[model samples]
Target: MKLLLYITLPTILFAFYSCKKGEVAEVKQYSKLKVTVTNQYKQPVSGFTISLKTGSRSISKVSESDIYTASYEAGGYTLTINKTGFIDFTEKIQLNADELKEMQIVLKAGEAYLKLNSDSILRLPSSSLSSIVKIQSNTKWITKDTSDWIEISKAEAFGDDEFYVQTKANLSDSIRSSTIKILAGDHEQQVVITQYPPIRIKKTIGIPGNVMTQTPSSIKIEFNQPVILNNLQSLYYYCISGTPLQPVVDSNILSFNYSCGELGGEYPFSISVKNTIGDTFAETINVGFYLQQLHFKGNIVTHFVNDKDNSFWLLMENPDILYKIDMRSLKIIKEYPLFTNARMITVNPYNDKIYIGYSGVAALYILNPDFTYKTIPIKLDSTRLKYNQYEELTPELYPVNLVFTKSGIGLLSLSYNGDVGNSRFWFIDAAHGHKTWYTNAEEMEWYPYTMDVNYDQSKIIFTNYSLQYFTVFDSKTMAFNKVYSKNTWNQGDITVASRKDANVYFQQVYYQSVVNIETGSNTNATLDALDAARFDFDYGQKNKIVGFRSWNGYVEVLDFTNSQTPIAYHYYRFFNSITNTLDGKYIITAAENGNGDSWVSQFPGEWFREEATQSSGNTLLKIKQYPSLIRKSQWR
Candidate 1:
C-alpha cells in the first residue's frame, strides 16, 4: 500500500538566503523545501497558515517544530495547502507512518497591494450655491468606513495597483456600476468614492489710485458672477464684479458705469455710491482744489503787529515758541523759541523787528537780527520809584500781549501778587532799560490773564475770572482816575473796541456783545445764551455768525439798523447743505483724545492724524488714515 502522506513545514529557523546568479539550497537530513508568505515585502505571515492535504485529510499544517507529520492509514494521496494572502502549494511527497516531515515550505507569491487615503476628508462649507456629485466604486464590496454605511469615511481597500486602476463617476458609464468577486487564491483590491466641494460664487472689484496723481482701476471676478468688467483703468476708475454686480461707495447709494472720454473730461470728482444690484445712486462732490480740511474745535490766539511790512496777525502757539505761518500757504515759515517766558510777541513790520517780553526774567528783547535788543533787570537800583504796586508799565512782571507806541514798547508782563491778584503789565524804553509809572497796581492782588488797554492807552480791562474790573489811568501820570465795575458781561468775556477799525465788540458769559467804545453801549446787540456751542463771527461777511446749525436755527445775519427790531438777510444754517469735509466731498470719523471725533480739515489733501504708537518692538499703527472722496468718474 503506497500511502504517500505529505507534509510541508514552513520554518523560520534561518532566514532564506538570497540566491545569487544561480544558487541552490543544500539538502540536509530531509529534503529541504523553504516555505514563507508575505504580502509585498518578504515578511513572515503569522495568521495565514499553509497546509498539505491528501484527499479528505490534510497531511499537516506548517509549524516551527522541524515539520508537521501526516497519518497514513489506508490509501495514499497528494498534498496541497496555501495561505490566505499566498500562493497554493502543489507538490507530491511520500509520507511514513507517524513520521514527522522535516521540510521547508518556500511560499513566495507576493502581497496584495492597494492605495487609499488614511485620514478622513470633509467638504468645505458651501456659499450661496448648489452642488452635485456621482461616486463610482472600484470594488463591489461597497464597504463603508464604519458600521453606519451612511456616514461614509475614507476606509479604502488599500493595495498598490500593478494593473490599470481608476474610478471616475460620470453621468453615463458602462462598467456595471460596481462588482465583487472571490478569487481562488489571495488577491488585493481597492475602492474609491467621488465627492464634490460645496459650490459657491463670489466676485469683487477695486479702484487703485494715487491720492495726488490720476486714478487707476482694476476688475476681477468669482467664477459664477453675472458679468465681469476687465481692464477698467482710465484717468479714473469704475468697475465691479460681485454677484448681481451690486456696487456702492459708502453704503448710501448704488454704483454704476460712468466712463467718459468725450469733450473736456471731468478733472475734479466726488465720491460715488451704488446699490448692491449694480445701480448708480448719490455722490458727494468736492469741485475745487485743496478739499481736505481739519476742523479744530480748540483754541486759537491771534496777536496783532505794528511794523513797516505790518505783519497784521500772528498766531501764538505757546509760551516759548513763535511760529510765523504764511496765511496764504498756511505753512510755518519760521519757528523760533524765545529764551524767556514769552507771553507776548509784538512784531514791528516797519522796523522788521519782533519784540518778545520775558516776564520771569524781567527782560524785553528784540528778536530781529538787527534791532537794539536788551534785557532789563527790574529790581530797581537808584530811583526812589520804590518797589511799589504793579500796574500798567510796572515792570516785566507778567508778560502777555505786548504793545508798542511812541512811548516805546510796553511789555504786558504777567505779575502775581497773591492767589486772587490780577497779573500786571510793565513798560520799557526802546533804546535803554527805563522803568516807568504803575497804574492800577493795587488791583493785581488777583491773577488776570489778559489786561487789555483801551485805544487811549489809558483805561485797562482786567479779567480775573469772577473778578472782572476796569480802571482808567493817565499815560505819563499813572494816576488812578476812574474805576468801572466789571462783571461777566463787561470784562470777563470782554472784547475791546477796534481802534484800527470801527466795530464795537464784547462777550457776556458766552454771548459776543458789540457796543460803542465812546458811549460804552451797543444799541442792538443780541444776547444769545448757549452751553456747548461756539461760532465764528463773519466780521467781513455781514456779521453772519456761521456756526452749528442747532446754535440758533439759521445764521443770525441781522442788519441792526433800527437798533430795536432785528432783521435777517437770510435765515440759514451753515451746516444745512454743507459738505463736512475740507473738500466738501467725503465724511470720515477719526479717533482722538480717547474718543472718535468728526472734523472738517482745512487742507483737503493735508495730513491730519493722531500720533503713531509702537505695536510690538517694530510694528506700528497709523490711526491717521486720512479718508478722502472717491472720484465721481471712479464711482461709476
Candidate 2:
C-alpha cells in the first residue's frame, strides 16, 4: 500500500483556495462646453443665465462675463440663455467624450423702448393752453425739460400714458423753442416745442401785384390777431401828393381805399399796421402807376399771339391796321397799314407767317414776320357775280373764318352778304397761296358758321348757324365724308371735342348736344341759366373740356368726357372771347367787369372745379382793358 501510494501521489493531491469580495473603482469621462453671448450691436453681454439639461439632470449658472464654461458627461443636452432685457435663447447639443465644444450666440433686444406719438416739432399758438403728449413705452419712463414757458404735468410714468404740456401765452416779439427729453431705461427721445409770437402781420390782399395800375381801389391787410388800427389814414404814404387815403378796420383785416389821379409813374408807398396787443409792423413797397389805353380808330376784329417773340398782332376793322404789341410791356411795337377791313387772322405754325382775310376782298393777304405783305387772288366764278341796282358788281364774299393745318394747308369758310344760299369753302396751299380746291356757290344750303380740324389734320368739321346741318369732309382729298341734320329752328356753334373723343359738340341757344361720329347717336342736356350759348372753337378744337359764353353774361365750362356736363360757372358784364394758355395753366378772358371797365383778366386754370365759387380775388393778372379779341400763340 505504501509503494502504491508513492507511485500515485500525483493523482491524489489536494489544494486549498480562499474566496473574497472587493469593490472596482470607475473613472467617469467628461466633455467641456463653452458659450459666448453678445447683443445685436456685437457687444459682449453679461449677467445672463446659462442652463444645461440632460435626460434626468440639469445644471444652471449665471454668466459673470460674456463667456461661460462647464464640464459634463458625454451626452446630448438642451442649453438655454436668458436675460431680463434680452430675448431668450435655447438649443440642443451633442458632445463627444474628451472633446471641447464652443458656441456663439447673438441676442436680440426686446420691446422695452420709449416712443412719442407726435412729430419732432410741436407748434403752438400764442395762447395759454395745455396740449396732450402721448407716450408709449414698455417700462418705466421719465421726462426732463429746462424751460420757463412750458410745464409738464407728469414727470415720470410707467408704460403707456399721456401727459399735459402746459404753455404760457407767448408775449415775446420773436418765436421761442424748447426741447423735452423722454427717457426709458438707456433710450432717449426728444421733441421740440415751438411757440409763435402773440401778434404778427400775416398777409396783404388786393395788393399782390407789383404795379399800382394792376391793383384795385380797395386794399386789405391781414394780421395774425385781431387788430386795432392806431391811425388809419396816416398809415399810408403815396408818392403822388394830395392822394386821398381812407381806411376801415374790420376784425383782423384793415381795409383801405386809395386814389391816385392821372399818376403814370412809379409810386412808392408804405403801410404801417398796429395790432390790439400793441404790436407794430411796417412795409415799404414801390409800385408803378403807368397804364396806356389803346384808342384804336376802329374795333379789333381779330388778334394773334406769337409766343416765340411774345408779340401780339391786332387787326383793326376800319383801316385794317395790323399792330404788333409787346405783351410784356403792353406797348405797340410795329404797325402795318392795309387797304380794307380784315375779318380773320391766323399764324402759320410752321413758318410763323401771318394770314389775313378781308371783308370785301377777293384776295388773301400774306404778311411776313418782317412786316411786309403780299396778296394772292382767290379763284372765283366770274359768271356768278351779282350787280347791285346801280349796275355795279357787289363786293366779293367775306372770308369769315380761316385755319391752317399742321402741314401748312389753309381752309377758308366764306359767306356772301350773310346769304345762306351763296356759302362757299376753299382749300388753299398755305405756302404758295394757290387755290387747291373749293366749293361752288349753292353747294351748301347754309353758310358754315364754324369750322375745325382734327388733331391729325385728316378730317374737317363744319356747321351752320341755322342748326339744321352738320358736315364733315376729308381735308386732303376734299371728299365728302358725312352729313347730319336736325331741322331745329335754333342757332348754334360747332366744335370737335378732341382727337381722343369721337363725338362732335354742338352749343345751341339753351342746350348742348354731343353726337358720336361713328354711331350717329346724340346726347342732349339743357344748360341752366344759359341763353344763346356759344362755344369757343379755339379752345374746344383739341380739348376735352370747352369754354362757352352765353348772351345772358354766363361764362361756363362744359366737360365732354362727363356726358356734356357743365362743370364751372361764372358771370361777367359781357363775355367776349375766352381762351386757355398753351400750357393750360391759365384761363384768359376778354370781357368787362361790374365796374364798366374792359379787361383781359387771367385766372388760374386749376380754380375751375366742380361747384367752386370764385371772385376777383382769384385773378392772377388783371390786365386793364381793350375791347379786342385775344388768342394765345398756340390754340391746341
Maximum-TM-score candidate: 2
What is candidate 2's lDDT per residue for 1-636, written digit by digit as tens? 999998777555531112233644467889998888999899999999988899788888998899988888888987778788775665668988999999999877785667998676787777887888898886667789999999999988877898889999997766689999997656798989987676665654332121212332345566776667655433223323233456777887777654331122223456566554455666664332222223355555656656566565677655567887665455679888876767778776646677787766766678876666787666665554555557876543556676676666666665555342344566666666455455563433345666666545456677766565566766566565545524254555555443344567766554556676667767554554234344442231343444433344334444434434333232323444454444444444444333323433444444343222212222211123212212222110
The residue ranges of model 2 lying beyond 4 angstroms of the native Cα positions read 1-298, 304-340, 349-351, 386-398, 413-423, 431-433, 436-446, 482-503, 516-522, 528-550, 559-570, 592-598, 610-636
TM-score, every prediction = 0.35, 0.46
lDDT of 1 by residue, 235-260 (tens): 23432222222332322212333222
In model 1, the Cα lDDT at residue 525 comes to: 38
Q: Global lDDT for candidate 2?
A: 0.59
Kindly report which residue stretches of model 1 are placed more than 4 angstroms away from their true locations once superposed. Answer: 1-320, 328-333, 348-352, 370-373, 380-398, 406-411, 416-422, 427-434, 439-491, 510-512, 519-521, 529-636
Candidate 2 residue 104 Cα shift, in angstroms, is 73
Task: Report lDDT per candidate.
Answer: 0.34, 0.59
